[model samples]
Target: KSKNPPFMQWTDEKIAALAPNDSTERRGRTLASSAKWNTIATNYEAIWGECKGSGSQPYLVQIKLSGPKYKCSCPVRKPPCKHVLGLFFLFAKSSAVFKYQAPTEALKNWLDQQSTSTVSSASKTLAPVLKTEEAIEQAKLAKQKRWAQRVQLMTSGMDELELWLTDLIRQGIANTDIQKASFWNQVAAKMVDAKLPRISTYLKETHLLIQQNQNWSEVVVARLGALYLWAESFKKRNLLSAEMQEELYQSLGKIIKKADILAQHPSSKDLWFVLGKKEGVDIEGRSFRKIWLQGQKTKQQALILDYAFGSMGYEQQYIVGDLLDGALVYYSKAYPQRAIFESFESAKIYEKTTLNTYKDLNSMLTSYGKALVQNPWLFSFPVGLSNLKAFVNDKKELQIKDVKDRIIPLSNLKEAIIWKILAISGGHSVSLFGEWSGLHFEPLSMLTEDGILSFT
Candidate 1:
């Protein structure tokens, strides 16, 4: 097979895209220019090499082109560390250096291990479905009993939380001092013990906001009210609609597993345009990557999340700006936004032309408010608007103005990048996409006639 295959060419631009940062890209370019690799070999699925690094022995480097996974016997910690990037750059610019041969023994062994690991994972996934009907019934009863115990614990935690909030309000939030982190940490620990981990997380994040934000008194109080409202709602959950109850339970940390989502939910097919990708590390040190996608035909948005533990890298199965013809099963929620892919008919590089956008600020906010009503615990909601202009306001803060001149402050944007976005627009209105976090809009990407420029 051709190393630089027809559909997937490992060109210089593609290699540049793969590099994690500009520093890494520059280093890879320098290494490739110096011809650092001593031996380079390629197979249909992989590229292997021995790079003469600044060490006694040459470093062994292997790239699983299919997995787009990189492994190098070097001290570098990041994925596709300098060596792998240089190898890819060489493969792209001068394929003549790589011998078209079968994989070496080491490479073969690694490939075999990867295959075995995948098979083992697939087998483990089937275990949940193997329970007999009687066993499933028993499990269900056991789960219900455990849930009852959790509810009792949670009630106690909520009672304590209510008293704490009442005390804080009575003392006045302006007079309160939250500098002691334990004020939040202790309550978060209690919630965790109560099996209300999601609530615990909300409290922890609120503590961060209290430290960082100037208007934190109002923000924290509002969030506390929302939390207390959710807790109270849970007390009368049976009176709520099925969708609302599902949303409540999910926000309370009742997770539906992958197998259940795949097996039970109905699938909806669309040509999904990936809008943006964000990667984050949680307090528990787990790595999470979320890809936001919007259907061209359906005009609906979906979020796909991938997670990894320590030292493990998430497999990036999709890329931004690509169109996937896929069927996705939606997770149960009042506002269904997250989904798991069920099947894909095909995928291709798609050129975006028109954006599904609101005509005015009122239109967008109305929709967002409706979604919040459906699920008050919603973190961020998507907003797309056309003929939107971005500029710095009097306070030097980035803001987006619609045709009607109604504007919202843009949060989380660097001042320099805001200028760049203005340059990209060239003083004219453009299509904009962002997330509304109750107070301000965090711009994700801007669409021009040429392409999408991601802010994340």
Candidate 2:
């Protein structure tokens, strides 16, 4: 919003990037071609317009060409709205339509406010970094008070869960109606009320697991045991190391602020390879995508997780099989895998480094075991196995045999899928990267001299 000089010209691609999807872009393009405008004006720093929509009056639309901030009179939840998008498309496609003029009064007021706020914020940010001793003490006291409240809530929740588990154990999970959704919902609701929504989610998932499996009692008991361990550990959290404490807080669903993370954590710059990516939606319906990268020099794996809500676009950069030079700020965790880009230097579709792979399944398991020792919360870890031959076993199950002839029966993989990897390998031992559960390896991609073949 600050009136900086126009850094770059707006293009069709840039307009498309602001749009949520191709459909939105198409609609905007169509509207741009036909929409009637009362006034279209622009300066170097911003553009403003009054466009006739399907309404009585024209909608006033203004966009700061610097931050690309949009303000429109239309009542659309999406920033910029369709009207603004149309305006952008018009500006990008043909700018001569806009008259060279000074900004309107409303646009001028907004720009002036933005400039004042930017100057004030700059002055504040340039102030001293350290707080006074008295201020520090007050902040520490407030933090302690908040933590104490959280601990009390968790304790209450744990007590209720302990009693519920006891009742189930005595009644027997087989006797209990695990298929009854209300039964789990009641307990999950209690957990939510106690401010432990993540635990509620775990309980709901456990109910589904019991219903899906034939051995419902075993699954129930095992999950209940894990819950008990978490509860007991929470009671003795003071004895745990700092890293374990951070892990415990994460497991409890405590949110970590991104600002704090970037401020406190160390950053590293390296040439990173885009290994793989996964996309999923959370319970709240927020769409998220996670891209995994491994550094060539540091040999460190970093995860870039991004989120978007309705009508918002995901990140377009960081394509798989590309190498990028960037400084990444890691989140404080036992494994330290998740990170955000602090600074990106350069990126290109280049693949030069050799993929690190284990010689055998035992070696892979050993590495996972070591990682688990440092971070017990890790349920799935990535591994690249070398010299792996894919074949069908006697039971018609797809299996991957390593250099030592040790076979690992693959799960979450079908015949046609294994055939693709086999076809890529041509019966030769190739480097395969995948996630390892305790039972099987879920191959994500296979690396060969030709290129990276994604199986996920």
Whole-structure CA lDDT of model 2:
0.73
Cα-based lDDT at residue 365, candidate 1: 85
Query: Which TM-score value belongs to model 1?
Result: 0.81
User: What RMSD, rounded to one decimal, does every model reach?
Assistant: 4.3, 8.0
What tens digits encode model 1's per-residue C-alpha lDDT throughout 166-201? 777787776444557787888889888887888888
Work out the TM-score per prediction. Answer: 0.81, 0.66
Relative to the unseen true structure, what is the C-alpha lDDT of residue 327 in candidate 1, on a scale of 0 to 100?
80
Model 1 lDDT vs. the true structure? Answer: 0.74
- Model 1, residue pairs in steric clash: none
